[model samples]
Target: MLRELASILGLFRQPPQDASGGDRTLVAQLVGLLVEVRAAARSNKDFTTADRIRDRLSQLGIVLEDRPNGTDWSWD
Candidate 1:
């Protein structure tokens, strides 16, 4: 599950060779998709999957904030 999620989130993507980095818009979209998946897992009472998702993101330096409106994330 972890591997699948990581792959889907492009965690294995190669680092950009240029200083400009990669596409910010695409990165945001990918992160948003993962966040939605995490929300669905939580709503389904699948805390293990939710936690795994959060942990994996954290390992990538993405900090997640659970707000009343929704979950927000930022680079750590």
Candidate 2:
């Protein structure tokens, strides 16, 4: 599943392990990683790559909002 996630965004970042099935933490690691990759692309001035990543996440129902501070996302 992790390998497939790399394929999903053409980015190679491992999903954080969820210890206790919750990581004793916050959001889904995979979603977080995807957002990170998108941000990195935008930072590199690669809007095309960023857009592709955003579109892929949207396909999975993850909607992203661009903010001056950063990007936020949600889905229904």
Candidate 3:
């Protein structure tokens, strides 16, 4: 778990490489899909899924905020 956390942190330091054509759109769609997955996991009481998502996002330099009403996510 510690190693995974370290690996995820390392991923955040690197930016996505420049892509051509439809790659940008694809990336956006993928991100959206991941967000939905995270939401579903939370609804299903699958915190393992949520935590994995958060950890993965953290690797990408993304942070998740847990609020009483809902969750908010952002990247740095």
Candidate number of the best TM-score: 1
* Candidate 3: stretches off by over 4 Å: 1-14, 65-72
Residue-wise lDDT of candidate 1 within 3-71, one digit each (tens)? Answer: 686677666364423213355556667779889999999999999999989999887677899999999
Give the alpha carbon lDDT tens digit for every residue of 1-76 in model 2: 4337556744323333423445423345666777888899899999998888888777655689999988888753
Stretches of candidate 2 off by over 4 Å are 1-3, 6-27
Stretches of model 1 off by over 4 angstroms after superposition: 2-22
TM-score of each: 0.75, 0.63, 0.58
| Each prediction's RMSD to truth | 3.2, 6.5, 5.9
Q: State the lDDT at 62 in candidate 1.
A: 76
lDDT of 3 by residue, 1-76 (tens): 5346545544223354555446545544555567777889999999998788888777766677878776666655
2 against 3, candidate with superior lDDT:
2
